[model samples]
Target: MPLSRTVRCICIEISKKRFNPKSLEKLEIIPASQSCQHIEIIATMKKTGEKRCLNPESKAVENLLKAVSKERSKRSP
Candidate 1:
């Protein structure tokens, strides 16, 4: 499905930051248009399992979250 305009805007904001694969828990690309794509990242809390969409505008926070996610993966089997 095509991403909403708000999501598209958020994705645009995200693309401007430094790319760090380690910071992202899960990243998926959803087709937005014939010439563009939308990105979705999983933003969740480790202790509570609460989930939310990544905020594209917050580079520092996103990077930190992604790092945490990476650490969790390493701790798992």
Candidate 2:
């Protein structure tokens, strides 16, 4: 009998580029953990409700994060 292996990371394929901010519904940031050593960024689309994994190291992702932060700050009282 062989031992069953379990998948660690939730993301199967990661997008090297960024998606349109207007089309994005939500963003989930998973920090580096024992299972996955790298930070994971998951985006949910507004229209399709599809989820995509984003490369945390990409410059586009950095800009997206900044934009989200800015928007959030403006919304805060």
Candidate 3:
């Protein structure tokens, strides 16, 4: 099979001062040496076996949920 890449949501936080465009390469090795004090990348995924509660009233969120349900319902029925 051809290689496929899965898209995962990632959130990155870099400190205010060191985020300047020029210093990105220089700051790679050393976190402290760079003007930015801390950088954090978090992948926010629901924990296993946990139910994801959705507010049906939300237009955008509910639309996504409806799309998923519709796809499954189509396959089954």
Candidate 4:
């Protein structure tokens, strides 16, 4: 028998409704692919170093992403 090899989505269950942008240490955006059919947003908490999965379709998530992008652009030369 051959062993089937396949990548899997890291997040099992998405986190609660909202997150504090200031508390987010990092945000990782995973595009839809074979393993995961939908966009996945993962956030790392600054203090606890905990990871949380967020809903990509939420308005709050959109705003948080925009803010992070803007901040990064400002830092770039």
Best by TM-score: 4
Error of 2 at 70 (Å): 3.3
Misplaced by over 4 Å in model 3 are: 1-57
Report the number of the highest-lDDT candidate.
Answer: 4
Q: TM-score for model 4? A: 0.69
Off by over 4 Å in 2: 1-6, 16-18, 58-60, 68-77
Model 3, 1-77: lDDT tens digits are 66323222122322222222222221112222233343322111233332222222334344444766999999995
Clashes of 2: 0
Question: Candidate 2: worst 10 consecutive residues by lDDT?
Answer: 1-10
lDDT values, one for every candidate: 0.51, 0.78, 0.32, 0.79
Instruction: Say which prediction, candidate 3 or candidate 4, comes out ahead on lDDT.
Output: 4
Higher-scoring candidate on lDDT, 1 or 3: 1
TM-score of 3: 0.26
The true-versus-predicted C-alpha distance at residue 4 of model 2, in Å, is: 9.8
Candidate 1: lDDT of 34? 44
Query: For model 4, how does the per-residue alpha-carbon lDDT over 10-61 read when each residue is reduced to its tens digit?
Result: 7778887576677778778998899877778888889999998887876557
For each candidate in turn, the TM-score is 0.32, 0.68, 0.26, 0.69
Checking candidate 1 for backbone clashes, the offending pairs are 23-66
